[model samples]
Target: MTAPVFLVDAAALAAATVGGVVRLDGDEGQHAATVHRLTAGESITLTDGEGRGVHGEVVEVGKGWLDVRVHELVLEPEPALQLVLVQALAKGGRDEQAVEAAVELGVDTVIAWQADRSISRWRGDKAERGVRKWTNVVTSAMKQSRRLRRPTVEFAGSTTDLATRLRTVDAVLLLHEEAEVGIGAARFPQAGTVGVVVGPEGGISPEEVAALAHVGAQPVRLGPHVLRSSTAGPVGLTVLASRTRWTT
Candidate 1:
């Protein structure tokens, strides 16, 4: 069976190492200790969220925290392929679901785009709040998935903003239902970073699709059946990860 994983801040870990008792203090801590029902001398893995992990055994238990002794430290190499998901804002909880799944699937980054047809809109403070909420969701998912690295989330102003972000990566893939080209046929650059753009429920407008294509973003079709915005990002990430041998 896979070991249970928890995310520990650098300070909490330091305390855990010196025979110092540490409490799981926040909601996350409570979840780890109470929900998981971990006990003294039991082993659990802790991740620093920056490609660092430690195997630790619980030494002391508190109402909220667990005192643990670090047994082994493991450093994982960064993924060979860096995948960024530029997801168009979807209604209700769908966007949050997408972010959560993307993180679990090992997406390196997420970009929230206010697509022209999106029903949910984010502006000013709302945009910042939305980003924070998605960030928290990704963090939680990362911990649950036992990932060593946390995915970064960014908010985009316009398609122009997305285009600018695409420049930082090696290649950008635009997933459009109307696109004729299959993802498997497209030749992804060797040892390259990839960014994938997924549209909203209403889908990407032809003008926006053209705009992305103009910026050298290759359009790829997943399949005949259309997928929900929440589902597309994870599916695309998984396919991309496998195609590039990012994860074994």
Candidate 2:
């Protein structure tokens, strides 16, 4: 079985080497010991969450910390073409679900898009809490998915926000049911970030779609069937993956 993974301080992992000590303490340590019940001599993996990680075996277990001796370590390289999901915040926790699944599916960044039709609103302190919630959700999902680097979280206020953001991206795809082209039709940028815009359940407004498209974002459909806002981003990401890294 794959060893259980935990996140640790980057500085600590940087100072560690083969046969050296790596520490896990505090809530993480509590989770490793009291929650997961990992004992001395059990193997575990640790990542610093910036693509640097280690595989080691536990040597000592304490009330609030666990020490592991490093065996193997790896530093994952960033992808040439990063996938960004611009998911509109949805009600009933669907937006949260979308972020969780997208990170697991290898999305490099997730931007919370506040579309015109979205019922969910992130305002005042709720915006701060909502972003924090998305960050926490992605962090947990990374551990669960065994991903070394956690996916990023971002927020967009509206179609105007999205349009301005789209300016910096090399390519942007607006997921619209009314689109004539399928996802496969578009040719991605040679070496830059790709953005996929997912609309709310009420669907993307024609104005919103046009606004994005006006800024050079392509409107494309996943398939004949319309997917939920939560599912569409992941599916779109998977399709891009297949045509790129997972092509063969």
Each model's TM-score? 0.90, 0.97
Residue ranges of candidate 1 with Cα displaced over 4 Å: 11-27, 246-248
lDDT digits (tens) for residues 1-248 of candidate 1: 56687777867655454334444556656777788888887887877678777777788777777766777777767877788899999998898898898888888888999989989999989999999988889888887888888888899878878777777878888998878898877657756588889999999989888888877899998988899999988888888877776644
- Whole-model lDDT, candidate 1? 0.81
| TM-score winner | 2
Tell how far residue 97 is off in model 2, in angstroms.
1.5
Error of 1 at 156 (Å): 0.6
Candidate 2 segments exceeding 4 Å error = none
Q: Report the C-alpha displacement of residue 232, candidate 1, in angstroms.
A: 1.7
Model 2 TM: 0.97
What value does the lDDT take at residue 104 in candidate 2?
87
